[model samples]
Target: MKLYEYEAKEIASRYGIPVPRGKLARTPDEAYIVASELGSTVIKAQVLVGGRGLAGGVKIAQTPWEAREAAFKLLESSIRGVKVNIVLVEEKICVSRELYLSLTIDRAMRKPVFLVSEMGGVEIEDLARKYPGKVHRIHVDPEVGYSDYMSRIALSALNLPWSSLSELSSIMKSMYRIMVEYDAELVEFNPLAYSCEGKLIALDAKIIIDDNSLPRHPDLQELYGRELTSYEKKARELGFSYVELDGDIGVISNGAGLTMATMDSILFYGGKPANFLDIGGGASRERVREAVKLMLNHPRTRVLLVNIFGGITRCDEVALGIIEALKEVSQVKPIVVRMLGTNEEEGRRILLEQGISVFVEMDDAVKTAVNLTLK
Candidate 1:
């Protein structure tokens, strides 16, 4: 589960990290009030997704009126489909330098890794790709924990001024402690700024807690549960994994691996997938119908692609589910299905009877779905 920037900053502050004074505002009036108190303020959209800055979700306001205007523009807008109902109005800082720092679990190494970079205020992926040498990584030994020596090594990589080293290292250690205490998968401070006053402050934050560990933290679970979209909440209730995407081709598959492959095939064939919906293995006809209904309900979905490679889930049952789904949903979108493996012939026959063409190969199915979108 991911926390909004404001929430992450609040948590980090509790852990002794220095962050700019900020207030959450749900209305333009509230923003004006906060900005008036803070003077020059940065009004930031409170969304759970990234690229918010690039999407015009972050704005600088030199006055309360400007802050109010910025908040008015952002409050009802959607950033990458996630509605921005609130904005974080923070005092704008004068930065002498920007740095990056983060702590995350490295699944490959099965240990927590600390990432530090002198380059900040931009996408870390792009930074790493463009200047891999600038970004430093340290794999922490869980048994040894994050010691002062590890902190020194991580700090040395940035080559920051001697004056900032102690504060930066302390912040890093505090972040590590937060990750451990909260069971966070990721805790990051991008643009960890060295202000004109020569103090290190976290200008931006992103925190993602492990979903499996949510049960251990009731407060975090509640916070994240409240952040879920209506569709996301419904998907969770249906026991399906669904993620919204920015495209018209809705995709459905029985397993995570196959679902990913189906989306990849669509992209490979010059198509974009609207969502990733995995119905999981051994889905019943009713579950499949629900999945189909869910896909059809998406406003951006112009076409649906159901790709099933049945093993425990029989192809014939999937076909029946699709047929049943078509009967139930209104304003049914165009559906292209690809079924292979168990009872494949019977499944194709059933779909054919319903005037639905079935593809034996994934590439062919994806190509057809993409073409239908052009029509």
Candidate 2:
């Protein structure tokens, strides 16, 4: 669950982190109104993905007229395939320096890692590659998140003045605490700039929360779901990617890693995975049914693949779910099933009886699935 920049900034502001004043605009006229209110603002297209500046998603304007022009241009554009419909009109700060600060879950370590650098505004990966020494990282225990001691360590690592370090450190710790409390995967503030007047302001903010944990955070749920259309909210609520793609193979998987692998495998074997869909763990029959219906309805999906590596998930359950889903949809397209792990035999039997292709090996399944798609 990715929160738009404005949403993230609002959250940060609640934690006493300084963020530039901004307003979300749904229309060109609204954008003009916001620009007029902000007076000398930076117009930024709000999207879930990164590299917005590189994609011309961010632009500065000295007046409301220029701001409206930038808004019109960005709102009419697409960044990395995501249509820019919403724009953020924010106050442009006079900065003495740009810094980077972020708190993100380190999957490898199963803990949160705090990152900071003097060289900001540039991508963190680029900084790591070019000037590894400039970037500093420290891992925090999930149980004992952010503390004053930890904040001191981060501030010391950044080599800031003693007087300014306390306030900056507190803000950084608060951001990290928010990340943990909100079940955020990545909470980042890039070019966390220091104004000429000595105030730290977040110039760019991004927060990617774990969708699996949204149920626990009602506030965030309300905030994000507020603007989403009914269909978009329902799609996300079901834990699936309804990303429209120009491909023929609609993919469905149980895990994020598995979903990515399926997409790559399809491409490798000369088939295109229409979209990334993860039904999530322990998907009920109805949820599975909804997923199938959603994929089959996709105009670009000529074929479907339900590939499951049932460890905690049962193959028999997936099989039954797909059957139930098919019963609801009057017409179904070509589907390939590869069931492995728990209840594998029963699952394979049910699919085979339905005249569907089933495979035990991943490579074999992918190859056969791609062939079916090409047909």
Candidate 3:
């Protein structure tokens, strides 16, 4: 699950990463109080999604009254459609240079990789995309763990000042530690700035923890109760891995890898995925039913795509779940099923009996589902 900027910064501080002096405020009066203490503050809307600044969710305040005005404006607004009830009131930093640093799993290599960009900030993506040579990537072997040299080497190639090497390396190591300690999918420090005072500080923080690993971290569970979307909370309660998206096709698969592949297949076929729902290994008929019902209930899901390469999960069970879910939900969205592996024939027969055609080829099923969306 994605964390708010303040929460990510709090975790960074615990790891010895320097972050701006800040506090969360829910009211304009609280913002005024915090700004008075900190002076020259930045008021940022607390939202899970990105592009908050572009959405006018971030504002600078030179005075306490301005801080109150900034907080009032943000708290009354929505950032990328998510309501902002809280704002991070932080002391403004005068930066000499802005840098980007992040660590995330490189699925292709099955290892963790650190990405660094000298030309960082809001335009980092565009800079790296248009000029790939500006971004330096450092891959760390998961078994060996991270060392100081990994970041140092990447920074050296960017021609970063030698004086700041030690501090920047320390920050990078802390970021790696945070990712491992919290089972995070991503830990990012955008604008890991070198301040005018000759110190490094994280101006912005974003951490995405693996939702499946939340069970192991009870302390992080408290964030979910208030932070997660309604559909996300429901999916968690049902024990299915789910992520909401902005598209028309809702995807369901038995494994995380397959679920991702299904979404990719949809995209390749010119279809957008509305959500990712992994029923997980050995999914029961009830879980499948719940997954189907969940997708059908989503207003954005115009079509359902169920791709099952069943093993521990039987195909018959998947078919049974779909049938059961259809009975429970009144939403009449089109469902496309592609079943293979254990009990494949039985599953196909069950769906066929109900006048639903099952596809043997995943490509054909995906294509049919994409086509159905146009109708």
Residue 83 of candidate 3: its Cα lDDT?
Answer: 87
Number of the predicted model whose TM-score against the real structure is largest = 1
Residues 2-96 of candidate 2 have per-residue lDDT tens digits of 88888889999999899998898888788788888788899899987778889889999998888888988998999887789889899888998
Question: Of models 1 and 2, which has the larger TM-score?
Answer: 1
lDDT of model 3 at position 279: 88
Compute each candidate's TM-score over C-alphas: 0.86, 0.77, 0.79
Give the local distance difference test score of model 3: 0.88
Which residue pairs show backbone clashes in model 3? none
Sorted by lDDT, highest first, which candidate order results?
A: 1, 3, 2
Cα deviation at 204, candidate 3, in Å, is 1.8
Candidate 1 minimal-lDDT segment of 10 residues = 223-232
With a 3 Å backbone cut-off (N, CA, C), the pairs that clash in candidate 2 are none
Which residues of candidate 3, in runs, are more than 4 Å off? 103-114, 137-166, 169-173, 183-185, 210-215, 222-228, 245-251, 256-274, 281-283, 301-316, 332-375
The predicted structure with the larger lDDT, 1 or 2, is 1
Give Cα-based local distance difference scores for all models: 0.89, 0.82, 0.88
